[model samples]
Target chain A: MTVLATPQPTISASETGTETVPLLEVENLSTEFATHAGTLRAVDGVSMSMTAGEVLGIVGESGSGKSVTALSILGLIRAPGRVSGGSIRFQNHGELLTKSASEMRKIRGDMISMIFQEPMTSLNPVFRVGWQIAEALRLHRNMSKAEATERAAELLERVGIASPRKRVSEFPHQLSGGMRQRVMIAMAMACAPKLLLADEPTTALDVTVQAQILDLMVQLKEEDGAAVMLITHDLGVIAEMAQKVAVMYAGVVMEEADVGELFDEPLHPYTQGLLNSIPRGHSRGSALKAIPGIVPNLLHLPTGCRFRDRCPAAHAPCGKAEPPLQRMPDSARKVRCWLHHPEPPK
Target chain B: MRNYLLKRLAQTIPVLFGISVLVFSMLHLAPGDPADLLLGPDATPEAVAELRSDMGLDRPLVVQYGAWAGRILQGDFGRSVVLNRAVLPEILKRFKNTAILTAGALVFAVIFGIGIGILAAVFHQTAFDSTAMLVALAGLSMPTFFTGIAGILIFAMGMQVLPSSGMYPARGGDFFDLLRHLVMPAITLGAVSAAILARMTRSAMLEVIQQDFIRTARAKGVSERGVVWVHALRNAAITIVTVLGMQIGYLLGGSVITEAVFSWPGLGQMMVRAIQARDYPTVQGGVLLIAMSFVFINLAVDLIYAWIDPRIRYS
Candidate 1:
């Protein structure tokens, strides 16, 4: 797909201050699960960085290791699954991957928080939504019960819930899906963390409510000045909200670029296929081009380039070895494709 | 809540009525005559006839049931033919003993049952989990009577640490002595039910701990202890409460065997003695009271559900 690069305003930390560091730097992270089938690599050598208040969207199909990366950052991977290799460096907190579980607990809802996908099943059914939000405040802020409860109601009002007082006393099952998602957002933003991990937060909501939740998240990020790692399979969400986009397939990122550049001139064939598959205004009456083949099983991934089996540009060299994630000349964009990095071995 | 209680109480009338009819009819259908038992083996035929008429045993089954029901409505359970005492007072005394035993057994069952269950669930797939579950399986397989006898042999006969039978010393022992006598029988009766409860609690906890809300709690920075106990256990309590209610009912009814083995002077032993002696009044009275308590215990359990989870509205 040949397309023009769209120029968009950059929101890099370097532009703000010469000495400012990125809020989160995840370097060469790998997460694996030991299964009876074998050791399955859910996330393999994934690397990315985000600055404060910036939005980085990781778009991929199901089972593409997006969620695992998010969980690894929080040190939440339970038994059988573990972070085998990684360095997660937070701005204020040193390498998080080395922190003890208790230390991680202190950072989790304080400096970095996460909002999960299914709002319906995410809230404790036995508790009032207000109490749930207040619990985080009480735990991290050491607020009095009365103070936390009042703040919880105010947060509910802030998130656009009506009759916040009455709603505060109601159980989670009493709320609709959209309202529950709003409650989740309110809770995550309670302590105003430096980074927020929203894992398909709007995936379970209705279409109309999806936009509202996204709008609320954008507003919260703006207010809190928190960097967001928004993981989703929806390209539309990436185009609308993310400043940077990372296209992941088979547990590896194929392309990472500014959102405008990625959408305008997607470098990888998989990224191009994703863009083409979206039914645009001009392609209304035509058939959409779908990427051939399904995502490879992580247990038995293809030997060389993971995407070679599904790439139309695949040739002899593509099967020889995996391509490194190389930066484009004079640009911040990065791509992992032999087409862009074709050079004879030394 | 008041309305709910009133409605639940109203619903029990038909149940008690149904239980009374079944107990009364079954006692009558059994082969044996209260008049013969009261008169003894050497009594003349004319004496037996006189006594049967005097006691209203010569009347039709319907007439006898109607007379019994009318007296029961007046808060009178009639007199026991063999014991020669008021059935209500006799039942009340025996019921107190049974209640004490049942409460002790329930406490034993719940504490150990829920404790072992949570441990097994938290340490799932470990040796402790496996061993605890194996013990539970063994407990479930053994009958209460068999357990009671084995308990007597081990603690009473072998170790000589407790009495083999009875609620207390005949010479008015202290509370500690009574407790010593109660320990063996209570554990014997509670073991099987505790096993059932432990299995229920384990499964319920496993299910609750896997729910997405638990992950949410942990994500909220709640401690692991808080996640399991406050978040998961409360959700699991709904099922645990249900099993507890059913097991309590079973314990009350099944205490008969344990009481007989221990000679604890509870309603179970009284019922057995009454049935053998053809004292129809006492037997009917004991069964009816047990059934009523079972119904009330269930009602309390339903109320507890609302307490544990506010989302459950009884209305």
Candidate 2:
């Protein structure tokens, strides 16, 4: 493990206070679920930021709170689950967490939109594809129904659906899984949002279709100059698309760095384990070096480091207290491991 | 869609036939002969026997059913022995009254039921939700007669706000007067069905709100109202409409109690009087009409199902 041997300055120091604002800045975001057993601090004090047209991938195992963090950014958390603490600043809108519902409504789908995992269930089954897409247009842009319908048809064509006019009138069930996902993308991009929170957008699609969706997303992001917060468990997806990467485990950021550096020289033990576990054809004969224990249950997490039990490099400090995410001295990376203890906050 | 409707209509033939046979057999199997009821107690056994043959009640069960079935096919429902009137015309007159009462009650049921149901679901886990659901539960279990009588006692007798019983035609064909008397019966009959519809709507809304599209809707900045009302409710409506159709069917049969309690002069009350006097033709004709109406209502509901969901139409 390089462990940020040569520390470098992160992007935020110079980026903030500049004339242009970074597309998104999520600070100290803490999400919790009020379950029957107990309160689960799902996303515990996570902080990640992105710039316009940038792709920031949040990669984690199942139940690691990556999706929860994305939902927090959108203020989309439902009852029994909530963003207990956070300030999500998007473009110029200050502290989205504190925005009134009506204000939030104005920002949602217009300035910030979302694409979900299951395309099959993500589109309303009853409505025509044209009407569904037109809905976003009408809500945010106040476009007349006729204009929105015509624009929806154009969007369908843009998403590569054949015979856009005909497909626009068809129901969601009439489309294939890939086509449904394309429709979802069209709806998400209808308003040309500045930031798109896509929680596993291609996870439910076939291998062949996943590439097409990823490519379409990249093209759309480039065209609109929109930032993307891509939440996925698939590291390959992150490597293929993201510029920066944040590795989350047990509701906290274990490590974050430029995508290339994070993949090549992982600083955190958890990040190393995650990267090593990916199946490779060259290593076919050897058994996969799977991560040691399963994720800790959020409701009854261990007293010290949440991943301590599962961590291979766990030691005395790991048992005593959980490590706060410490920024490296000269590196543009952050890790919440005890070995890289930076100056404590005064 | 047309083919599907034609197929559905064809299927109803068997169902209607079965209901007719059941209605006919049930009346015949019951004790108390119609001839005996028509003739006085002072009449001799021979006189009763003469009346039985005159009324064609002396024939075998199969022969009697065939003759009655043939007449019914020819649009002759025979006549009411006790009422001394043609069965078809008397039932039709009362049918109009019942139709009005049912239509009035349905308007009340659908409006309040769906509205309150959506409110309860959107405000789920709140005091309004709990209380509304509780009232809905009561509505579901409480019989129509109980509510009908209670409405009369409270609104008519105690408050003197609305008339207690009967239609308005006797009081100078006053349309508003009919409405005044209609208030209690409509509410009483509609309450249970409303509760049923409300409960179905609440659960359906609750389920729909949890779907992935609802979250997608919120993420896209659709207002919370639009999310719940537009996106979630449209999906929930699929289930809600199915139950509403069933409620309409069940309410038709249940209207009997409500009509009798208020003496609204509808088919249900007439049927009650007919059953009491052992009027076989009126009872049989009324039952057949109700059974057929129920089937047709369900058919209408199925079409509505297709209309609400594009998925259902193709299947």
Candidate 3:
């Protein structure tokens, strides 16, 4: 690992006014799904920016829309889902999303690639491992069959698969979960995409395998200079891999800061609840710290702030209107909570 | 896989035996006299009695069953009293017609059923999906006879497009002519299977698409087509094949109304004619063939189960 002056670069040198042009700028993205009860706001007003070479971790619980955010970026959200309001702008890359099906198809595996949570089910069992890896290469790169096959084998080896030449001929069911995940990684890396979105890539693996996969991703990110959007509930993985962190609750971002600063000091009550809920080594004898109450349903989220119902610090004003991301006085860290910053005197 | 095949084959014996016994007994008890029908209404009593004795229909039921069983064991399905020759040869000749019809129907059904299934599933809940499913529902509700008549009227009567029915031309032996003759009957037989399969495919695809891996495929930036075809469709294979296999058995066993309406020379038509003439031997032979085909089709399905799903391995 190469160490720079500061692990979290406020803004990289040789780039004047670069902050004005985020590599990816998602502004007030709200995705809704029509349901029996009401419209569910799966990704509500989630806005975040990522610079090139930045690994941004969006951490949240199961229903917190972290995965949905990653999926929205790829334009993979299916019907019954509407991207109601928002603009996702990419600076050098054409546009964040194309409503045109054919254009979306082109960018999917070529420009922006993703790895899913489960390696076992993600792969087509009937297909050979090498063929699946070659598919993306053949589709996106216009590579010949022979060239794609050869490169697929090489990719398997690059992702640390042993005897890739022989293993490539085997079907997915023949490989173990960890090996399958490695194959997933190989497939994602086939086109050398600029942004690699990994949504719980290591969640289905054992602890040891998870560490290995995480390390491999970090190594690949550094080597390829690919920005990674890591979505997971594991703060440890976030701490290890992410340069920046965004804590989400009920489809809204609760806080955004440099990973170091966020880990050192989490401002929003929801963020603090999540950090406290982690099973620490010192809390072995005692009960694990779990945040009281469940995540509110997106169909009927509280009017003001989504987390207010579960937040211990919620006040009467919290029920009136939602809080927007406001910078802290001492640092560049942004928190979206009324407790941290009161509304201007009316 | 070899072991699975051997196991399946071994398991078919009891099934075939049971089917033979049931068919033989039912044919024996059927309310008709072959001798009376063969000799005609004007024949004298002694002459009819002599014909019955000659055909061994005068023997006790058990003895007649025993004789039939013994002959079947020696690969003899006995003589068709009406044809006055070996039952096997007559049935086999008729069977060729049925086989052609079944094969054509199967080809038509599998292609159209699976095609519509994939289309409906991929376009789930859309206008196309809804329209396809609605057509399937209509197909299921309309009886085979109605569909057969509708097909003949539309294609044969109104359009003046092609030959309406029958197995071959009057001149005979031309493959293209036989295929052309087969189209209407095959369509009539295949329609219901296609409808059933479309519904099955829709439900199966719906279930498979909900699986976690489908989401994984979509997130991997796989195209919508790839997600539905390569991932969801393959995952739904076992169920789809199961419905198709059952349809295959149904086609082979009978296409009665379709055969009658189209005048296709299938076993179903032969069975009806045999029953009307009280040709006991021919009826028994037809029933036995259908039973055996049903058993074999079921066995084929069980054997293919392992091939389609790698999770099932014969111990």
Candidate 4:
């Protein structure tokens, strides 16, 4: 557990006045994917925001729609999928982002960057890694081929790869998995985008490499002054890097708060279940505390709280209607469980 | 990859030899000897015997096969007993016609198939996509001869847009005229090829559009077209190429009924005439060319794999 004991001194709140608005503001975002069976609401009414240079972690089990939420913010959901309702307000140097696909394309890699989960498949095999990175710069900026190539080498070096010049000429298949991911990061950082979307950036790597990559991202994010939306299933990574934590379960946000607050007092039963599910060293020999049931099917979600079926703290009222994500009176935390309060107001 | 290619090339020799052997034996074993067929049923025994000896059909089976095989090795596919000339040259003339038709049809198939496939996959279940897929399904169900007839009826007889049949003008003026004559048959052939290829492309594109990289591309803010063309299409390319390669083979195999109906003098029509006349040399020459062309196309596809995907290497 590499959770920080004290908040980093660099981003002290007093230094930058609260007047500085958040770089990205996602509000009541819901996305559904069409299937033969029926429409599946993969991301249901999720909301979050990130200030410049801030790191936000979205943690959940598989199928919790954490990834979908991140993708929805970027308008990346494809056919059979559509963003039913929501607004993703991105303020990059105060320029708004409501535009057509072509207009959005101009801003995508230029002003905002994204790193995918699997580096092996993300990078196109037919092209050189340098070409991919150079393409981002060339498409967004009006740089000549020669200049983009030179800048690509510099980027590879910035990402800490050795022999950037030689490596630039090689295809993606010639590189190792970690190196490919580094190349992806380098590409994302090429234009110095203000917001970086890292969707499970390190989940595919080995444990040690995962830490190294996360550290590299943090270091780069500090230098670039870019906000990051870190989507992952690993709570350890979230504990280590995220300033804010968002917990999701079965296509809805279960709990969200400051990292320290969420860890110290996990209000939602699903969040508590997820934290308890992590295997401790001493508890290895014994049966770990597992969540009793699997996530309910998103297409046929339960009527009330989606997690009520698996939640140990469910009451009779939970079966009647879905719970709303409401704030706790004493704290800044927002939770979506009825157990935290006596009952839902009529 | 280079080593792998060299190995495949080395293996193709045995494959070609085996195909030739099987084709020659089958043609020879079929009823009616070439010499007898040429002399006809009303011919005297002396004339028939003279024809058999002249045609080298009087020799032992092993000796005849050896001489014919030796000539083939020397790039001489033996003489057509009826035509009184080398079978290779005669076959080559018709082979050129088939080759042109195949080339035309292939270009049409690839362009239309890839275009429609990408559009349908991108639009998915929209009316446009449904209509495109529906057209593809109709194309799939219609046989080649039916397509040719429909093409002739609409374009030639009804619309008066193009000529109905034949590969070239009887006088054989310019090469362009020959191409102009081939358009209808080529489109008829291409329609069938396009049907299967379009479905394959749509399915392949569907599978690829779901990959994380395509999502990453979209997340990076690449436009819908860019996400599809640059990311999804490129990833789906290997599968598309595989289908395209197979379709090319089908096209190159030539449409027999289409060729016959249109009076297009391709290898297929030539082979039909040779078979009906029991011209062993001509039939062997036609079958051998078709097999060889198919092998060459497959080899070309193998070479293309390395270009399309850097993961594949000849060494």
**Of 1 and 4, the candidate ranking higher by lDDT:** 1
Candidate 1: C-alpha RMSD to true structure equals 4.6
Steric clash pairs (candidate 3): none
Q: Write the per-residue lDDT of candidate 4 for residues A123-142, one digit (tens) a residue.
A: 87777888788888787887
Stretches of candidate 2 exceeding 4 Å from the true structure: A1-20, A342-346, B31-67
Candidate ranking under lDDT, highest first, comes to 1, 2, 3, 4
Interface RMSD of each: 0.8, 0.8, 2.2, 2.0
Ordering by TM-score = 1, 2, 4, 3
* lDDT (10s digit) by residue, model 3, range B1-315: 787788779989888878878978876566667677778889999999998899788899889878888998787987776677888878888888888888888888888888898888877888999999999999889888898888889988999776887777677758888878888888788888888988898899889888776765665557778888877777798898899889998888758778888988778888898887777778888888888878888888887777776656423
Cα lDDT of all candidates, in order? 0.89, 0.88, 0.83, 0.83
Candidate 2 lDDT at B311 equals: 91
- Clashing residue pairs, backbone N/CA/C < 3 A, model 2: A7-A330, A7-A331, A8-A330, A8-A331, A108-B220, A108-B221, A109-B220, A109-B221
lDDT of 1 by residue, B185-294 (tens): 88888998899889999999999988988888888899999988899999999999999999899889989999989999999999988878778888888888898798
lDDT of 1 by residue, A28-125 (tens): 99999999999999999999998888999999989999999999998889878999997999987889999988999999888899999999999999
Tell me which of candidates 1 and 2 scores higher on DockQ. 1
lDDT of 2 by residue, B57-111 (tens): 8999888788888899888998888877789989989988998888888999999
Better structure of 1 and 2 per TM-score: 1
Which model, 3 or 4, shows the larger DockQ?
Answer: 4
Candidate 1 residue spans exceeding 4 A from truth: A1-19, A344-346, B1-3, B31-66
Instruction: Provide the TM-score for each candidate, comma-separated.
Output: 0.94, 0.92, 0.86, 0.88
Q: What DockQ does every candidate get?
A: 0.76, 0.75, 0.42, 0.48
- Measured by TM-score, the strongest candidate is 1
> Model 4 chain A, poorest ten-residue lDDT window?
A1-10
Clashing pairs in 1: none
